[model samples]
Target: MKTIERRSTCPINYSVEIFGDKWMLLLLRDLMFNGKNSFLEFKASDEKISSAVLTEKLNTLLNEGIVTKITSPKNASKFLYMLTEKGIELVPFMVEFLNWGSRYNPNGGPKTLLEKIEKNKKKAIAELQDNLRSQRHSYTNNPSDAF
Candidate 1:
């Protein structure tokens, strides 16, 4: 992972430095929930991120070891992105963010998943984390799932 200079020693400051940008969190959300991998898929997101910004954000994630890029076996010209173990660790945080959004914003999160999270927070988080791990491992080994 590439290290960036810290503005302060505070953990919150460190976190904000990495995730303060809305785009980064949205990208993480898409990776965690939306089954998006290729650049084209990301560009197709409802938020409509521009090509330059998407490339920059993806590169930042790659530099931070929060995401990995792999060549698509099905199409040599394309690539797929997956979260790393470090990135997978953010699943709980993402869930809480979703829950927060569901509570505070009119249309911020998916209702069904938010209900699941509310019902059993730990189980829901674990299930999400496990799902991400399974996806990453499957991609690494076989990539039978779509790119």
Candidate 2:
């Protein structure tokens, strides 16, 4: 991990420094919800992040101990990204963030998911966090496989 400069010792400032950018959150969102693992999958997201930017952000995530890269078992040439325990802990925050976004953005986000989250926030967060932690390196999109 590279040395990071801090503006202050505030936790809020620390979070902002780590995840203030849209790209970082989007990358995490894709990883958590979309079951995206490879660089190509991230590149093909609706956000259309550039390769250079994606590489830089992914490296930053690696350095921050939030994400880890693994050699894909099926493809020697490709690498798959997985969330660390630290990253899995962010599941609650992400669930709330998604709820907030879905509340304001009428056309965005999954309505069914939003309803489930609204119905039981704690259960939703717990289920997601458990799923992320249990999956480890398996980034399958199938709910049965992941859960």
Candidate 3:
């Protein structure tokens, strides 16, 4: 694990330390929603991430245990990346992020869905988390069960 300085000891400060960047969120977005697993697919994102930066961010997530890398069974030379339980737990945060950006950015996609979520934020978040749990095979236990 990497050690670093903190601006303060607040939980928000820790969040900023871990994910307060354009690249991390975008990379995570691809994995969470787009179902992108390969390096080439992530590189092909609309954000146009540079290869070197992508490599660095992937490594960071790996180090944090937020993502796992598996050797492709079909192709020895390829690797697949997927979110771990920790990463999947960020769905609600991402939804809020979507809500905020959609409110300010006219070109944001899924306008209707965002409006529905905006009206019923709690319900939307719960539904999304449940959806993610169902989709992830590794989730032997429901995450919501923990809370």
Candidate 1: worst-modelled 10 consecutive residues by lDDT: 138-147
| lDDT tens readout by residue for model 1, 1-147 | 556788999999988988889899999999998888889999999999999999988988898889999988788899889999999999999988888888889766776788888899999889988999898888889766644
Model 3 earns a TM-score of: 0.77
Candidates' lDDT values, in order?
A: 0.88, 0.85, 0.77
Q: How do the predictions measure up, each by TM-score?
A: 0.91, 0.89, 0.77
Candidate 3 residue-wise lDDT, 1-147, digit = tens: 665467999999988877889999998888766768779999999889999999988988888888888665556698878677798889878887887887789788586667769789888877766665554544334423322
Q: Residue-pair clashes per candidate, as listed? A: 0, 0, 0
Q: In model 2, which runs have C-alpha deviations exceeding 4 angstroms?
A: 137-147
Q: Assess candidate 1 and give its TM-score to the true structure.
A: 0.91
Q: Which candidate number would show the highest TM-score if scored against the true structure? A: 1
Winning model by lDDT: 1
Descending-TM-score candidate ranking: 1, 2, 3
Please say which candidate is ahead in lDDT: 1 or 3.
1
**Clashing residue pairs in candidate 2 (N, C-alpha, C atoms within 3 angstroms):** none
User: Which 10 successive residues of model 3 have the least lDDT summed?
Assistant: 138-147
Instruction: Write one digit per residue (lDDT tens) for candidate 2, span 1-147.
Output: 564688999999999988999999999999888889789999999999999999989998999999988766666688888999999999888888998898799687977777879899898888888887767735444333433
